[model samples]
Target: MAILTLGLATAGSSGAHPDHGGGREDFPGEGVADGSYKQHDGDEGHLPAVSRNVTLVGKAAVTNPSGAGNTGRVADVTAFGDYAYLTAFREPTCENTGVHVMDISDPAHPTEVTSAFIPTSDGSYAGEGIQVEHIDDSPFFHGDLLIHQNETCPGETPPGANSGGISLWDVTDPRSPKPLAMHVGDFTNTAGGLDPAPNQTHSMRMWTNVFDKKTYVALVDDEEATDVDILDITDPRNPVLVNDGLDLGAVFGVDQAAPTNLTSVFSHDMMITKVGRRYVMNMNYWDGGYVMLDVTDPRPGKVSLIAESDYAALDEERSARGHEISPEGNAHQSELSPNRKFLIGTDEDFSPFRIVAKIDSGPHAGTEYTATPATDSKQIGEGTTISGAVTFVGDACAPLPAGTGTALVERGTCTFQAKLDAIIAAGYTAGIVFQNHRDDCLSQVSMAAAGPIPFVFANRFAGLRLLGVPGVTEATACTMTTPATGGESTTVKSVFDGWGYVRLFATDVPTKPGKAGSIRQIDTYAVSESQDPAYAGGFGDLSVHEVAMDPENNNTAYLSYYAAGLRVVKYGKNGIQEVGAFIDEGGNNFWGVEVWKDETGEQYVLASDRDHGLYVFHIDC
Candidate 1:
């Protein structure tokens, strides 16, 4: 029911906008081998060409009845002792209950410990924010702690009323998980009111400073304008909000007082690393680039800006689209190198192609609509034009007023797949989806449904433009439901603008007391097909999703590439280079990954595949 929400920007600032919070990211990509494209069976698109330097020692396809969004059966993976905690995330409907327990003592055969599963929150969903740590210093309990985010099912409210923000449990005994905190942030009511329901959150990190010895959780709150929400979790029984809804741009912008209007920049993900006594938080902020902050004291007045990523200039080849404009900024996620030398970031571009919807005639004739892809349909493969098409607006979300069944889109009542299926059945060339003002109307997300014809998704502004309606923003709560096309002929030109990739930066950690630290992007990496036109449309999205660093080898990191598979990279002063990669014969749609070591200190990578299940691998190089 969600489309990539690439809305228009007004002004204000994260500096990227008036462009709005950055979130244009993710998808499949390029073929690695020379053989022909092998079409995948369960999932759409061809299997990425294979390559292997990582060995799959074991695999566990966790059981999860598909959510409405068709999310990965298993999301984030974290290990404590011989047991691994795998979080289940299916939006709208959480059929899988909660977290899945897996016994990984035997690395060669990872098995699910069904008896140890935690279902504290039926609606509790965790995406890339799942961590289990043995924090013996917490005042609450001297045992293992498990924390996961409850970001809710986008656009739909699930079961639990008090399960909105973050959930914490005492997992001291792998077989038993004692619930400590049900909801530990601003909670959303069943009626969508504020106060006990969890504030829609995406990613979070928990760390106990070696110096302060105080445990804290940094969360990315989607419901708040000032996204970063910090909490003191030293006592897991009751979390105290230390910094509530603090806008990173205002406090740390180049001009602290008048921070660049972070129009499109919003905090997405974060990496907490200890630099000496200072706890540095490297945040993946869309459009705002990666922002580094010092949170050693865990207070606003004490926290200081370490560095902020600036994409003012770039190598022409790295731009992908060759457009004169700046790169479509979607600073999705980031991780710092273990050696503290550099950090790698990802700009997730789900819709690598931009669709220019030009109005041919009618009341608002000749006006063109171009923004992020909004319609949540399968890949269009090789951009093409949906020419000489007549525009019809359907109520996608709900049924039209009694007897009025003429809208072209599904609005929101049915799945985009259902709508796209109808469109294809009706012989429509393509489709476009815009976000409702209620949720992230300005954010860009990559949610899709398989369809034959091309489908694109955009933000509220673009949606308004397509319907010839005036701009209805997230603030005003645009409720004008009537769809109007003004009887115009539409020409939709799908242009390939390249997919999301990685940006490597050389970081400078300030040694002097008053000196400011900084980060300079050293290089960019994308699959050859993602950069080349010859491989366009045939191969799936080559965009990188998440990266897991190898503790044993600081120079080595593992990437869970959607269709590209697991890629191993080595980085240093020489920059980053792919040393190894592994893609199953059927291709891989990996979402999240974690690196865990067994009792003998043998390191292995755990990845969550969207269509498939869990995969365990060991890096050879």
Candidate 2:
């Protein structure tokens, strides 16, 4: 069967020149915490000359203001005029919540607009698919509407079990937005369902151009076993499906670079350009970089692959030793420049550097390199430390170490054998590992079966290590703690479990200095750590997240890093500088970012924090 093809263009500044961290101004030190706390024992500081200019901006409490609590985890950001749209998984107070609207007319002072309920979720398992837009017309008729993807219908039970769908809101009134309508029922149920039956929409957009007098919105129904659906939402209250399945060329033919056995052209995220005359798509986890499809014929528009940048083309090892979640390489979030000259993508891996290919030209042509250092500079040879923890899952800890002794293990590496063997080889004590991030930690059942030495798992940040757990390995354990804390910091209660234990220390044996994977120095804290493939354990607080900038004004950028809340900066030829930042002293993570200008000539910044729920900020400080 012929498949639809879409041309993918590269956008943004080409070339992976050294990130000098330019375009930043001195940050007002008042009301801000010490920026020199050392993110990772030996990581860089909040300087104004880093490759990605991200300064810590004023941070507002997303969980509790009076109390120092948080709802960790930020996702994406959408800006419309002077407002910012934030989507978080949940909040400490709201808990597994929804979207938050923020006002950022003043970048320094951000205020909350409003928050919509998304209901509780099993961590990242259940939640909402959110996207906001300011009224624009090009290929389709248009009106004011805010559309978000729902994991399930509004009133459904077990949102986790229910499939995803779409929800429309009337944001004509910025202050008070109302739910305009929700497409539900048997047909809506099977849009893009996980079950063979399909049930939710993955990606959606409304286009307005020379084509129609009314606004036309198209949704990629994940539940619909066939094609994407084009809907005529000329009337906000009344929407009709123009075409459910737009025919495209076969996915195999479209995927020219098949480094691994992954499919191509699977409907993922799409961007409307050329005034809705063309739509570019990134088929889920595939080889075809970007596809350009002509939606002129909404019913049967032709889709073709125009340009592609393949990761496998550069690193074939990505396919063989790649992790399961992103085995085919993450063709995930991709953006194109306004001039439609460049296309940039984000790889979903913890590699020291991010993947930036020159979709346009030059030495960076089909090239991808690490955006940042994978490991700390000093820790480059003595081996990497695995102590900075966020969320640990697994069994409760049992007393040991002094009496029988306990072993500390990290979440990565599925089998507990490596840790146990290392412990047994060293000859001593009980055993325990920080639980995996994504799964509940399983106890070392077989080891305990033989009257094991208090085999247990510590699932708390405090319970993760044993700073001074005495034994033959006492020196190693003591090395992990900060000498300033007098190396006497005891374990606080675990976030998941009620119990706690001292932390442990086990650095990878030091390799040659400056070597790719060597530990060089020792520090009091870790800004970034290592990750484990098994149980997806290594994904916690080991890597540096992403930061984005405004093309017109590079100095204006947002940093949504883990633990590092929302950092607003003004970058330029000077150097990377910090303006202000908002951080949840408690646990909270910041992700995706987008800045928009509304019709009212106002600027809004939207940020998606992981799990903490959506955050709305007004940047008028």
Candidate 3:
């Protein structure tokens, strides 16, 4: 069994990136605190248990029989005709729990038609993003084709195992889905530093272009070394690699040189849409932001750059800190309006902080300083100013010495929470400032909990300056401020202040024959005021996850607003407006949502909750 650890960063810049720490770690026994699982307590625990015009039609507790040590969290869901396809991560035991096929013909009660698992010599399982495509009058095979990415955790791969890519299956027999082929790709460790190149496939999207008379599948390479891989699946059984390394930088007309921060340049997720005669692919490049490429000519294995968007402009304030560039913002996912006039992008920064400090007295009095907030520190208030003596904890990365004094600013190891606690125990009431251990700029720190007092982090130069000051060593005093409240406030501020919002852009030329021709910035849309702090667990309080367009209405869009539940927005000449929303009473942590029309022509919204099972809602609008 694996013990879930809440301290481990689970939130990705976007939903597509693997869990921050990389796959699930194994530990003994059931219900152990392994730091892998997130505590769904408080607002994240349960939904409100109420409903509006939206009614929960059908649900399947696939993850039930919990305590198996595996992540019961359902990854993604896709529907076709009378069935729905669901994929789940491997169990804690590293057992394969592949795909779950549901008979959703009756929306109110979904029944599992069949469950499939991938066999691995090492016991690791398969599952991540799953999609189904229908091929009619094809030269290869016919009926429904199921394709799912085969993703294993960072260290979970067996010896001599090349275990990551897309798995193809024939689901014509829903009760007996047969595995057709497994296209194994490259593998690269995601634990930071370079280990290898060409990472494994994380998520994929496949479609048959009627106009081009061919089928294509695009998969994210999951590592920083590679961006995306395009495959030709015209012969479902024999998938061929079209391009192993489709460089987004080259396609976007940017420098092909490797970025200093490799994580920022990798491809995390992608979606393909047909706008008029052009087949466009919208890629969510981690730090690169939103990138659009023209894939109209896939046969040539070449993609044309359309328009690329970056959030560097938003980093001006952060760059001013220590005169160092702030890390790239996470551009996790991107979706377009039904009319393709507006592009909705999501930035996924799990834990973010803004540093604010000022010297209250001494020669440095009135001198302002910028320090980042520790993810584990309690939120500081604007009205509170903590003053104390300047002290050093210990050597960088070493344990603090016993008998440390109180109310003193201690500089020591970069990120040892235990050392920080030791200083607090010695009666440090004012605050603590940690010095960066390496030459790189001081980045944000993720802690398990907020300590007794405020904890601010300083860059190397700032730390050296403080150490040199006589007053600072004797009786240094400083004021610290953060968002209003503590826990809830930190959660809200981290997202709102960070990069996880929507960015809309226009192309240099018209995507449609009669649409506008020039490129320009469109208006940005955030959650409505109703989601303010006053309303606990409101839509505006959470980060935006995935967005889906209403097929029938070019102006309508549906969003899975993580903890905010489901929201419906309308965008057009009048601008974007929130037309409707439904926050389940049970407390919703919605991950992905899709809008589909049934055989009877009635439109419904299918939403996947990280905690709850599948939810089917009637789109009244």
How far is each candidate from the true structure, as Cα RMSD in Å?
Answer: 7.9, 18.6, 10.0
Whole-model Cα lDDT of every candidate shown, in order: 0.63, 0.37, 0.54
Worst 10 residues of 1 by lDDT: 29-38
Candidate 3 lDDT over 169-230, as tens digits, reads: 88877767787876444443444343332345667888777676788888877543335777
Stretches of candidate 3 exceeding 4 Å from the true structure: 1-53, 65-72, 90-97, 114-128, 136-138, 154-159, 187-198, 210-212, 250-265, 299-301, 310-329, 349-499, 503-519, 529-541
Best-performing candidate as measured by TM-score = 1
Query: Candidates ranked by lDDT, best first?
Result: 1, 3, 2
For residues 1-621, what per-residue lDDT tens digits would candidate 2 score against the true structure?
322111221111011001101111112211111101112211222212222223334344344332424434334556565655555432222245445666666665667764533332332212223555555552332445776654332212324433344556766565677766564212533325433222455456666544455566666554332355677666656666666555333432445533332322344455555522344443322233334444544654343443344333323222222421122233334443343433333332322322211111222222211111111111111122122111212222222233223334453433343444455444433444433332122111111112233333333221222322223121233233222110112111110100000111111211122111111111111122222223123233332233444454523555454444555654333333456566543434456656555566544445565644444454543
Better of 1 and 2 by lDDT: 1
Quote the positional error of residue 502 for candidate 3 in Å.
Answer: 3.5
Which stretches in model 1 have alpha-carbon errors above 4 Å? 1-39, 42-44, 48-51, 65-71, 91-93, 154-160, 188-194, 254-263, 312-325, 357-492, 511-515, 533-540
Over the full model, what C-alpha lDDT does candidate 1 score relative to the true structure? 0.63
Q: How does candidate 1 fare on TM-score?
A: 0.76
TM-score of 3: 0.68
lDDT of model number 3:
0.54
